[model samples]
Target: MILNNPSRKEIKNVLDHAKTIAVIGLSPNPSRTSYIVSESMQRAGYRIIPVNPRADTVLGEKSYASLSDIPEKVDIVNVFRRSEFLEGIADEFIKIDCPVFWTQLNVVDENVFNRLADVGYTVIMDRCIKVEHAILK
Candidate 1:
């Protein structure tokens, strides 16, 4: 598991301050966890950028194929992909330079956590943003 996961204070701070999030691996299917989480964040007033190679739009927002394709800066990059793909996503995140990297529940990648945190990113792994939001709010 990714160590040094964000504390309650850090997670709360992130939710309080973050205005926009790029949700990687977001799905068009409403039943999917990615879609539900993105929707919840949107409801909470965060500008949700749905990023999926196969989708043009999700939850009424225009989606991008990748983070690099996004036109504006994102405060957070919430990932829903498997752990095996995280390093590649981390490589992409390095280019985007978003301050926060959030890997959803059950997704954990220690290498990504170390590398991203080393570069000053606030990384959260094996956590669901929606669940946290519900608790912290």
Candidate 2:
């Protein structure tokens, strides 16, 4: 079956309870959307963990090569990758303690969404986390 995005109420609940967000495909470049969105979220009081293999650090936090490399529990896994790259990260997402898997605007895949939902993850696709936080919180 297909999975739908959590309700605004549910999204707010997740954002309210969440503290740390693991940003997959985050870039060190300030001009990138991931960096911009992540920075905005960081300023809004959520800890941002950059999960990029090419960068050692970003926005003052030590970057991990992958989600599995992060030493702490993650509240959210915010992805900034194309749909084709999503399958590669599914394993790490499931291995972590993240409750939410949020994809940035324009990034989406139905099969992946359904699979994550089947495994009990709250998945949000093609939405901006920063925008949601600003509107819903």
Candidate 3:
């Protein structure tokens, strides 16, 4: 089954209300695409929680090994991981009960999205959160 993302208005609402984002698979290296997008979003005034096991910190923010390790509430779980790893990430999302689930462009799995939606979580796959933010303006 194919997955359909929310409308632009819904995306805009998520962007407007979400203040803190837990970025899973975020890399410390500036050259990486994850780092670029995450950094751009951070600069746009969103508090970014870097979730990378291999890095102690990224973009001046302390990084956690996983979303389960984040101590505070996170508005969105932005994933930059490959499609094959999404099921595991989805499990973490289920545990955290985050309001929104987003994956970077060209990454998606309909089954994972269906599971998130089953739990009433807003799912956004194959979309760039940073681009959506810019468009909302």
Candidate 4:
């Protein structure tokens, strides 16, 4: 079966209860969309954990090489990677304790979505977390 994004209310609930967000593929460059959006989220009171192998840090938080490298608990696994990378990222995501898997705007993969959704994961795709937070919160 195909997958669909959760309702706005459900998405809002996830954001409402979430605190720490691990941003995969987040760039250290401030001009990058990943960096810009993440910085905004950080300023909005959410803890931003950068998961970029190339960056030492982003938004002043230590950057992990991968999601599994993060030591602390993460409420959301927000991905800024392209569509082709979602499957690989999803593979790593299930191994961690995070509950929500969010893909930035224009990023979506039906196969990845179905696989994660089949296992009862909360998956949000093709939507910007920062945009959702601004509209819902």
Candidate 5:
């Protein structure tokens, strides 16, 4: 069965209450969309955690090799990786206690969505978190 994302109101609620966002595949380069979006979010008051195995840091925050490496509480797991990499990310996500799993624009995986949703995780796919926050907040 196809999976649907939460409504605008639901998304707004998530953004409204979220304090920290863990960004998977976040790039250190300022030219990348991930960096730009994450920077915007960071400036907007939400703590941004960079989850990149190769980078040491991004947006002035320490970078973690994976989701499991983060030592703090993560309210949202925002993904910038391709759809093919989502399964691995989902695996790491489940190992953590993040409440929301968000895949960036054009990133979607039915299996990942189903798996996370089945386990009562709030999954938002193929949507830009920055845009949503800008419009909803």
Candidate 6:
């Protein structure tokens, strides 16, 4: 199946309408891109759910051990894990039914992309949400 990757316009719409973002694999280190990006989104008034088993908290919010652990609905699932581990994350993502499944820059898996697309998810691979948000907002 040909996956419908979000166009720039579609991405903009998604970013514009999204209220909460679940950042999978968010690191506690302030220098990490995930940390910085999530912080920026939070400052912009988007609720950021930091998902990282190793981290207890980030950006002053309690970190969820996994996507399944998040209590509230997540509009976007921004993945920070490597390509090798994406399938597992995708598995978790499918169970939760997030509208957006975004794989961070340089992370891609064709099989997972196909799977997510088949399920009607708007998948964005190898794109930085922070950069997109800066440009779109």
List candidate 3 segments past 4 Å from native.
none
- lDDT of the candidates, in the order given: 0.92, 0.91, 0.92, 0.93, 0.94, 0.89
Candidate 4 overall lDDT versus native: 0.93
TM per candidate comes to: 0.96, 0.96, 0.97, 0.97, 0.97, 0.94
Q: Give the clashing pairs for model 1.
A: none
In candidate 6, the residue pairs with backbone N, CA or C atoms under 3 Å apart (3 or more residues apart, or in different chains) clash, namely none
Every candidate's CA RMSD: 1.0, 1.5, 0.9, 1.3, 1.1, 1.9
Q: How displaced is residue 105 in candidate 5, in Å? A: 0.7
- Candidate structures ordered by lDDT, highest first: 5, 4, 3, 1, 2, 6
Highest-lDDT candidate? 5
Q: Candidate 5: global Cα-lDDT?
A: 0.94
Of the two candidates 1 and 5, the one with more favorable lDDT, higher being better, is 5
lDDT of 3: 0.92
lDDT winner, 1 or 6 = 1
Tens digits of per-residue lDDT for model 6 on 25-113?
A: 88889999888988998998899999998889898899989999998999999998899999899988988958889988888898999
Pairs in clash, predicted candidate 5: none
Error of 2 at 67 (Å): 0.5
Give the per-residue lDDT of model 4 (tens digit) for 23-80: 9999998899999999999999999999999989888899999999999999999999
lDDT of 2 at 81: 92
Superposition error at 116 for model 3 (Å): 0.8
Measure candidate 2: CA RMSD: 1.5
lDDT for each residue of candidate 5 in 1-137, tens digit (9 for 90 to 100)? 35599999999999999999999999999999999999999999999999999999899999999899999999999999999999998998999988999999999899999999998999999999999999998
Candidate 4 residues lying further than 4 Å off, grouped into runs, are: 1-3
